[model samples]
Target: MQVEIGSNFWTYSLCEGRERKLWWESEEYSKIFLKSGRNAFKAICNYISADKRKVLFPAYHCGTESEPWYESDWEVEYYPIENNFTVDANKLKQCIIKAKPAVLVIQSYYGFDALNDECNALLQECRNKGIIIIEDITQSILSDIRHQAVDYYIASLRKFFAIPDGGVLISRQPIAIRKIAQGDNNIPLNAMQAYSLKREYFETKNKGIKEEFRAAYVVLNELISVNDNNYAMSDVSLKIWNSFDFTYIAQKRRENYRTLSEGLAKIDYLAITRTFDNDTTVPLFLPVLVKNNTLRQELQAFLAEKDIYCPIIWKKSPRIVDCPKETSAIYERILCFPIDQRYDKEDMLRIFNTVEKWNV
Candidate 1:
């Protein structure tokens, strides 16, 4: 079998599922389900029309997360993050004071808890100053670290699950919203059709299906990039979300991550970016930092030849004016190893063995 370890989710077949309450279904928050994460962020920016329209973001990011801000014409500033992707509370406090941003957006990368006691205290101070806190839980969605004190939370559910299109916006207090409406375009429809083709390609290994499926992704990307309006999630995608067995999914991912960590412990050319608590973190992927950029790219190509795919999480964009040197280096050297629920310990071992062979 070809070991396709990363990339888009395949089509999911509906099955009997477990009954449980989602993390955001609490009575304390009013929620809206959107077609994608970008829409959720756009809605929040529209809702919170701050006097200055200034917002703060972390320097280490995928670069696309700030699009809604720019689309809405908000002034954006970034605060530096440590090498391990954690925020320094003192530095964060200093940035807030200097920037005087009306809004602060924070994220916990790869399902690990980024906020400690000191960070939480700093956020409380920001709230006291009437700064709105928006936690981007895209990576930390299913993890145990849910920050309720934040004024708002936004996440893309499709990132964590096999849904075609799903994003959510949650506010601490009840907020009046217009009735949910679909976008005038067909991005969701295109995505579902693309995923369905991907599933067929997986089953038949047909070259034509492969070409069509790949091309569909490119078209879908263009559609998503230009889609700025807020839209509701499709009925089919929401049904898939409702039918997921989240508990089992979390358990399998944790096991796979632990297995990979154990197997790669002796490798010298690379290291896992951050340590995560097994009890709390259901990591989205195992982030590995290579010693340099050239070696990282070579290793990525070597693994791809063996059918074990890994991804360089992101490239730094020129629009980010203030990223520190260390953070920029991370963008060049960091790679994400697949540890999702779809693969088991054996799959992780394949990744480790492949990397080990390439290292020599």
Candidate 2:
């Protein structure tokens, strides 16, 4: 299948879905606002001080996710995540007590997975200690299982839908949210253009098209750092969010993930890290780690030649974030293959064939 940074491009049908009201801002729940995930993180960090700037996050993450903490003058530290992307509770507790960050950020990678009992215990301990918890569900936004007792929730909805730049932030407590109004329409404009360019590149493989796509990406990347963006999702983002049925999207993703997981599990070349255990968990992607780093790079390049783009999940952070050896190894070896609802079983088989034919 054709892929770009993530999955399939937005179609006109996506623009035609019905509107879904904002459900997270009610009394029983928290106040949910829309922005970029990094911007959302920045808004929360505004409430804490330099001493409390210590934010304990998972070892595996993108630089942008951690940049808010760094910019806030927080002592950003990382706790270990297992090879399977599961939290190591005992290790996490140790890091928490040692670092004593003002805030703790936990990511439910790829949406459907939940925290283990021991990890839950650690979450309780953090809460008891009065640590501000920020649960990032950018991947798990629509998962049936959710994090409880968290002070704040953050997610990048733009990843799930064809939205033009949107992130959701929820504050369980009645704290007045903060933001700076941006009159510029550059962010959404760039976002829309970026999507169009990628879809075009996918359709027409002109060599220079990628350069144009990269230019659009650079603009989108620059837009994310905006400090003062007013409340709510963009007017356009709300329309895109409203036009779709989440249940259908979630189910389709599950079907695609399960199909790929079963077929890939039989192969011996690499270790599959994520498996769809049931219907409730919707995977953002199918994660696999090649045993050899060199072969992994080669396999990725081979796929790219055929227009099957795979995400490396993330590269090692240039800033050393005190990660474990296992976590570091994982960053270097894993591949995040797109298994969203964009394609069917036959499409997955095509991906499997590419890997199967790789000369590892």
The lDDT per prediction is 0.81, 0.74
Considering only N, C-alpha and C atoms within 3 Å, which residue pairs clash in candidate 1? Answer: none
Q: Cα lDDT of model 2 overall? A: 0.74
Q: Pick the candidate with the highest lDDT.
A: 1
Model number with the top TM-score:
1
Candidate 1: clashing residue pairs, number:
0
After superposition, which runs of candidate 1 have C-alpha atoms over 4 Å from their true positions?
15-18, 178-180, 183-188
Model 2: which ten-residue window has the lowest total lDDT?
Answer: 4-13
Tens digits of per-residue lDDT for model 2, 100-168 = 887888888877564788887778878888888888888877777666768888887767776666776
Residue 294 accuracy (lDDT) in model 1: 89
lDDT per residue (tens digit) for residues 1-360 in model 1 = 334677777756566555876677779679888888887888888889678999998888766678778878999998877767788898888889889999999998888887788999889888888999999999988888877559999888877777767788998788655655774347667777888988887778775787787788888767655554677877777778888888888998899889998877768988776665557888998888888998888888898777677888778867797677767877878988888888888888888888877745
